[model samples]
Target: MTNATTDAMTDATADAPLGRSAVFTILTTGYTGSTGPGVAATVSYVHDGDRHVIVDPGMVASRDRILGPLAELGLGPDDITDVVLSHHHPDNTMNVGLFGRARVHDHKAIYENDQWTDRDAEGHELTPSLRLIRTPGHSREDITLLAGTTEGTIAFVGDLWWRPNGPVDDPVSPDRVTLRTSRLRVLAAADVIVPGHGGPFKADETAPV
Candidate 1:
């Protein structure tokens, strides 16, 4: 691990994955549906073939619902090596402090050159993976990571789809004109679609993208 200074951020990591391409595993916290917002507090993790990264921890839920299930997966809050947040929203970032020594990553625009958030105050590596894309429709900080390893180019659209049951909410996305088009674009590439919450799905599945 390196320091959090700007000097520490090298170019994006372009190394090809060594294992069976790269596998991303997601562990969800819970779902939320209300008249105002239908978002779910879905947290997840991905093993980039380099190490483990828990993307978002989400709001406090039943221990069994959140951390306990992760513990069953041979992971605990402490085992999370890195946390990459989609945005600084309260639902996605509330449990960040649980990472302990784990590093936290967000776009430079999200956290700047600072080290440490309320959780894992010693966060580092704003851009760890290669081909990280910045798609800022959901929020100014929204980012998507693209990996071109043998796994067939995986793309992680932070909160772009929240949960992957649908691509982009057609109504709220770009006046709803481009929602279906964007979802097809996302489905064409990437073998696996890993959302911010719940489990991953094959790119062709009806699951969220």
Candidate 2:
């Protein structure tokens, strides 16, 4: 139940012991080739024993940065069991196809696919331990993945808000009320919050108003 920041895969491996599922945040700087806002994005994955689940594989532009780090950790796309998309936003789900054997799961409202289905108002459990809660606001299909890891409940919130610029908001959401309520639920539920952009933070310090 320790938390630490690492820039290299080597450092993370040395610091984390086996059997203790660790969350690794792979930061991929946003595009800046004169077409988009260039907002930086993050790719997170949970390393649980031999099983790895990727949350928000990030955009295709970050293919190497994301895959390279996984390879260094002795994991490839084939090793990933689940590709959980917090939402269908390009920043969060564009690279999902890269994981050949991984099953892609997302809010069914986003797409009518068999791989995943929409949950009830009470939400649904993807596994005996992991729960996928539908928390729309940032997007109609927005959802949060809650997993009880060694570090406590880690919530992978896709585009809930941008945190790098000091408590920044999404700036543009379809429904403000729904978004507000969603944020509150996540803040109350998670001990560690991993946003769609920026690094992970303690839920208390970044509580939503």
Candidate 3:
């Protein structure tokens, strides 16, 4: 990545709230692919009231990189009250042990452990402002979080769409049909999408210019 891109990633990272909650995305070089433009995964956090909810914390090695941005904003692991994994992938859910003070959440099918929360099959209402969405495809337990923001709805979807090497393509997942169904469901309501292996982009701007 260029210096400009790196700087943009840091500058645009944590420090503000998207809606009434403190939400931001942190990109780490934990898993960059050869053909991937910026194979960095996005680890997002939403501070709803006193609850600090982290979405897809990325690999275990990315803990510091993830915490660096949080520290800059005067936050830390103790501040994290919840950890929501979009799926059980190592890159997305490996750092669950880092947050001892937080509760882990994932799809019921993937998380049968007593420590982790596997809510209703239809998904759970995290808060009045935040809701969990089941968007299985990449994995049977894949999920997405919809945060009601002042700008509109922002969907934190893990691997719902990928732009390998900067080219937006229908990235391969476990099931194409289910992926398409999830995409359509999210597109119908999401204004912005925070993808797994890329940066954030406006949903409407995803169309060909």
Candidate 4:
């Protein structure tokens, strides 16, 4: 893995191709203040051949923050084929309905229309380039989405680090030990990480242990 400074990492991987044709874009970078009244979920978009995926389309200052970028890419809500939630937290799932045509993937199963298909997310591949891996930390059901980009593996880890530097200790994590284990697992496999409440960053020694 090439050790890159955070800025260089983001610039390097932003347009990196996934597998042969997959690509991802951060629709909106999120933020959480020390306290009251300021929080937003970092949303992302992934496109791999037939799959038009939206990752963590949650709370934002406004819906336009999500849609505007999609429009720029020539997409609308109806164009999305899948929606993957890192976990079930409302902040990470509230805007899912915007893409009612999409099949939703969570830690447990796939939901589309009225059909609910039960399956473990671990090792589940939405495509050859994009897949899911169970990494419970911020929440017991949390899962990370991995995309095989040319730059390396990019992981969309929901709240796993909160931001690149991390909280060091997740104030809300149910299991600190498990969270640490998961963090190491992600760092081992991913070259870049798109955290739940922040922008993308390189996964390197600076990642919280």
Local accuracy by lDDT, each model: 0.53, 0.64, 0.64, 0.85
User: If scored against the real structure, what TM-score would every candidate get?
Assistant: 0.63, 0.74, 0.75, 0.90
What is candidate 1's lDDT per residue for 1-209, written digit by digit as tens?
22322222222222212233445555664454431465456666566545667666767554355677678778877676767776667777877777776766676533313564442211223334333344454555655555444556565665566555643462334434233333344555455655554345577756542
Ranking by TM-score: 4, 3, 2, 1
Tell me, by TM-score, which candidate is best. 4
The digit string of per-residue lDDT tens for model 4 on 1-209 reads 23333333344333322454568999999988532567898999999889999999988999999999999999999999999999988888889999999999999999999999999998888888887888898899999988887667889998887787798888889999778777777776788999988989988988886
lDDT of 3 by residue, 155-206 (tens): 7877666432322334446677666566656665567777776667776635
Q: For each candidate, C-alpha RMSD in Å?
A: 9.3, 9.4, 9.7, 6.1
lDDT score, candidate 1, position 203: 70
Q: Tell me the deviation in Å of residue 164 in model 2.
A: 4.8
- The TM-score between candidate 1 and the true structure equals 0.63
User: Model 2, 58-130: lDDT tens per residue?
Assistant: 7645578788888888878888877778777776777877787876777763222354444452355545446
Q: Looking at model 2, report the run of 10 residues with the lowest lDDT sum.
A: 1-10
Q: Is candidate 2 or candidate 4 better by TM-score?
A: 4
Clashes by residue pair, model 1 = 97-119, 116-121, 164-207, 164-208, 165-208
Backbone clashes under 3 angstroms, per model? 5, 0, 1, 0
Candidate 4 lDDT: 0.85
